[model samples]
Target: MPMDRRSVLKGASGIAAASTLSGCLGFLGGGGGGGNQGDAMLWHAMTESETETFEESLSIYNDENDAEIVAEENGDLRNNVETTLPTGDGPEMYRWAQDWAGNHYQRDFLYDASDDIDFNLEDTFSQAAVQAITVGADDAVVGLPVGGETVTLLYNKDMVDSPPETYAEMESTMEEYHDPSNGQYGLSHPIDAYFVSAWMHAFGGYYFQVNEDGEGVTGLDLDETKRGMEFVRDSIWPYVPADTNPGPQQAIFQNGSAPFAVNGPWSIATFEDNGINVGVTSFPTVDGNTPSPYTGTSMWYFTTRMADDEDRRESALDYAKWISQSEERQRAYADAHSDVPVLNSISAEDLGDQVAGFKGSYEGGIAMPNHPKMGSVWTPTEDAMNAVLQDDADIDSRFDEAAETVRSNWEE
Candidate 1:
């Protein structure tokens, strides 16, 4: 994956020519053509804004080859892959994050892509992005990188000439700037499942523990992660109002109602367009080490539903390798938007001098846990994390309780 994951979240301001991308060969819209269709490949992805991206990308890929390709916005692949695959109705390729790669690979539902695909992991992607996706004891290759996105801190320059460099400075700045009486909030921190884990890890806490052997892993390392949760609980509230939830507050932050907001580079344009002079920084360090904001990478994976069907698999494999390795294509893709390209050759021109400490995120960020058990912990974790943020209980005690729940839920 590319060095900066933060870029993907940015709106498509600088993206390369969408028309040129539509020229790619074999990308289709719907999934139903027969085997006779020249190298037709189907793709399944989420209904995210990014999904349209892959659809547009397919038009480009189809232009490259005399083949029929289709990309369907299938939403959550986790729940649908089963029925779709067994019926041979699954897409030839599916968009998935690295976290979900392992469990499916272990279930024998995913293809061992390494055999047919020549992925220059060393050359095509950054080393850290590679590690973030790999799994199992052997860490076999299960898929190819579609894109990589990172987390970055965004601040309003008008509020503070210089944004805080450390956690202490940030908190103090928020306190000084907060003016709830006039309806101004210093920060817009959200307490939801998708984001809670992100902030928690960035602050140096995590949900699970994996041993050196990589076999014994546990849930919610409260012992180590509690500090992160507490930090979130204590530092963000006074500056925020009760009614402002994630989506609305994010709007507030963009509109200048909040001076400080924690978000990825994807949200940069929103802040910029609203006349907010913006600055980007890495997530601040806590103790000796900076908290690890989680990383999420998108990839193309083939399903075993067509395991015995060699022709489509070969076509799918060929297409996957080509786009992934096309430095020109990847560059164009990034030029269209900021999501970090998997191709290592991509330039940092889009980011330039605005973002500091980005390389740190590209290097340090770890993928969200992909293990099956991961889905189960979000509810309890969010509840506990939310409780702490509202100051309902002692941070120490609340985190301790969350940790116990996480540990009990861990399967592997």
Candidate 2:
């Protein structure tokens, strides 16, 4: 999949808030040491509610631990962090992207958590998330997975009324469910790069073409992506109706104007808040296999700016690992934020009934592009998909165009 933030950026609130809380709770600042024990100051970019949640967790930690962690919500804490690392003013604890984690490792921004962290990796979390955060080209420890949002099928219950049992049924029912005469579309997703890569993935086409040897190399799959694009462009978007597609999809779903919509979990809160009965499932089936949502990894990173003292650095890594690798923490995350906890202990078995229906979808999730060029692929790709969605281009040809855009923009 391409590197646009939207595909990976679904479920916006949870990760950002969790990072801020964890960063602040573990933060140590000033001399990077406390009085006697030395004080640890953490500056984090967390929503006010999230900041409060972290403070409560800290209250629990303080009751047991000796180190005092002082934290505050820094409105621009994420941006302020880089500035601090160079001047050594950054928080001792913070959460950042894997790419940022890699860069900071070269700069010596973070510490190693191998020995000091409490969580047992063999028992906690997915292998992919752990591997992505901890291993890099140099095998240097970089960051931890604070949380992630997987792309899943988001449909308006009002439109479908009853969820479709199979792909054919789903499509057949769309005609009945959709009401263009009422100015409602069957579904709506932005016609931009972030949204397009996923629409492609659901169709079984990938950005990186595999050589005959089976090693991942570079080639465009545009030639093979037509069926999926046509289904969306000619079948789905037209039913959504012109002008009724609305501005951003969140608005459409919130107002119940769009009978069908597909986005990510971050929008879960809005749906629940708006009192919309939402149905979430695996991305969708095509070509005999259920499609996967593009999974993006978010992690806790250490920076070069922290004190070179191995002991303090170890503590920082411990903090990151604790949050990233703990089932207890992930469960707490789900309870506070509506997330599918990503640990072995908190499996589909542990999610209970509310999440049981959607757990299968999480298993089908796919990792988004890790290439440095991924961030740049979104715009053109979205434009290409929009061509299909807008009825401005042929569906078969439009997806091929999107694939070309992905290839042109991909770094690999």
Candidate 3:
């Protein structure tokens, strides 16, 4: 819900990739013009395989509509959209966060495709996806739902026979497999707010208090959060590397040195390409319940600038309709990336075992809050997480300080 990237720094790979890819794709070099007469431009930050899948799917739309649907990689898409849309920039449509749709709507940067795209909104996507993309009382559609990603347990099947159901089992398994000398560890994940939220939520902790309207956020939940923090300090830290940045953890997992990891579907192709037998399942349970990981929905928005150019707007809507409404294109995209399609019409059975595992993992998860207030919690929480993992840490005091910081940020 934050208006900027800092809040989502650690986990905003799709957005981050867009910023980097924008440069690589020469958009930063000022080569491509804002969308013109012939091309209906799209900018997305999808991973390599997802990009490949999406581009192939675009071919279907392009051929049928007699349109050139060009999807270029943009690393800083959210920011780029913010700066350029009002100025009538190129991308008639671009992929972005479902949660951020409201922010864009409030800024009047997005076009409401509620009537333009021909489909039963209620019958197509899950209620959550619909809710994420809708804004205000009339609930206009600011974003078209594509697919979503959730953090789940990805274990090397040849290393672990079955996924552990409880934290105790996971600990024992970690102890069994974790041999750091040969570049192996029980678990691999950056101990940041985005990744740790799963453990916290399972312990009945939350980042912010949601208001009655559910559109706003209030103060922090410090006490329950401390309980989760205690587990992180006493349990998870010992099993992971001392320097567990995301890059190294992924490298360790890719090397097959570590059997278990907590990641999204983005890594599935990489592991498979490396010939590792990967197994997917829900995040391990704490107490008797599965911890809720944050779910990030990928959505495409029709820009307001496109509305003036009727031709491009029609083409953009057609492209959105083709990918989102067409079962064949949706299934192909989902199958290609092993991702959970946001469309309710696409059954889990059709998504194969691996993607279905991610879907099952996400059932307990909460959608990441889209409100601007969410921005206040991330930095303080991430700092607290890092501090608590230290050897000379004071858990309660650190958490209390962090909670106070969030409260202060909210007050500001």
Candidate 4:
């Protein structure tokens, strides 16, 4: 975690050289041998336009460094990376979320790129970005940070003159705008743990703690977490629909039936395409505390298989450093994907207003626990939230039950 929310929304951008690779990296094709010279493969899950952006970015790197880089999109990316790495047959590099770093590192499948990459983290990227890739007690750098995202308050500017500054104000907006009978709502968000984490942090709660040993200690703050749950059950539930998921929540807001929503930047393009005059900002303060959404990052992970081949590892690290450290490339990516860059060199003036707010949300946000134990949290939390919304039990008791479920899963 970096500074409290106030500091993070402040700024961050990368560079593409003007060259192209001679050959293509097979899309979803089988992994190939280590690079004989400057050639290497990068496997990722990006689609359509995203794939084009990635290829273009790498092409810049390839042109600048005389590297032959093959970039490919794999629908089965995660499964392939997990199953193939141990056999020393995975791509030299792969793209994955920051949270996946811990599980993959634990499996002894990831390469430590601390000594390989050329940039100084403190000077180049946000503290959160640096922390996202660092692993173990030694704090080795496991990945090179790229695109980042966090949930924020997305509101219709046409419906309200400005975004709400506090939860109380937001509630007042809900009171004024929520007309269920008229198919309109002031606010609507998915009722999953992913979205609810913002509320949890607003109430000063968290999922787990990581020790100096890089080990996780389950630290689900029961009391504060329950307070968060109570707010959702007693307060927000009344204004929202009986049931809501991502699609319906986005639909409600995009169709003008909802004036506000909590969503990630990924939805911004869709909202714009539908002609919604959307405005974004950090989630309003709750109980005088900043709302902390779960920060997510897309990063480049070097594999043990790549590290085994000295030439390939060197080429991979060079490319990763170029993509991550180049300020111009980072800015280009931000423009192409509507993503917020993690590099500090990009400057605040470059990101514009709405993106700065999302960056601010990331600043005030908490990193999702990378530990495998986090796998146990989502289902139990979702079940508890659903039960409370359906009036299945008292809020406190339901939350207590959910905490127990999380602990049980961790123990198992």
For residues 131-194, could you state the per-residue lDDT of candidate 4 as single tens digits? 7888777777888888677778889888878888998898888889899898887776766666
> Would you list the C-alpha lDDT of every candidate in the order shown?
0.59, 0.52, 0.70, 0.70
In candidate 4, which residue pairs get closer than 3 Å at backbone N, Cα or C atoms, i.e. clash?
9-360, 13-346, 14-326, 14-327, 14-328, 14-329, 14-330, 15-326, 15-329
Error of 2 at 399 (Å): 6.6
Per-residue lDDT of model 2, residues 214-322, tens digit only: 3333323354456555555655555554532224445556667665565555556656677777876555555465655555555656555345556556555555555
- The whole-model C-alpha lDDT of candidate 4 against the native structure comes to 0.70
Work out the TM-score per prediction.
Answer: 0.80, 0.76, 0.85, 0.88
Model 1, range 1-412, lDDT digits (tens) per residue?
1111122222121122122121111121332322324464555544344455666667777786766665555434455665556665566677666666666776777767656655467766877567655666776666777666565566788887776667778777777768878867788655454444545675445766456877544445445567666556656555677642545556667678777876654555556666888776666665555656666666777677446678777777777777777766565545444456666666455344343334446556766665555555666666676676664776667666776766565533
* Candidate rank order under TM-score: 4, 3, 1, 2
**Candidate 1: lDDT over CA atoms?**
0.59
lDDT of 3 at 232: 74
Q: Which stretches of candidate 2 lie over 4 Å from their true place?
A: 1-43, 97-123, 156-162, 196-198, 208-222, 225-228, 241-248, 352-359, 394-412
The most accurate candidate by TM-score is 4
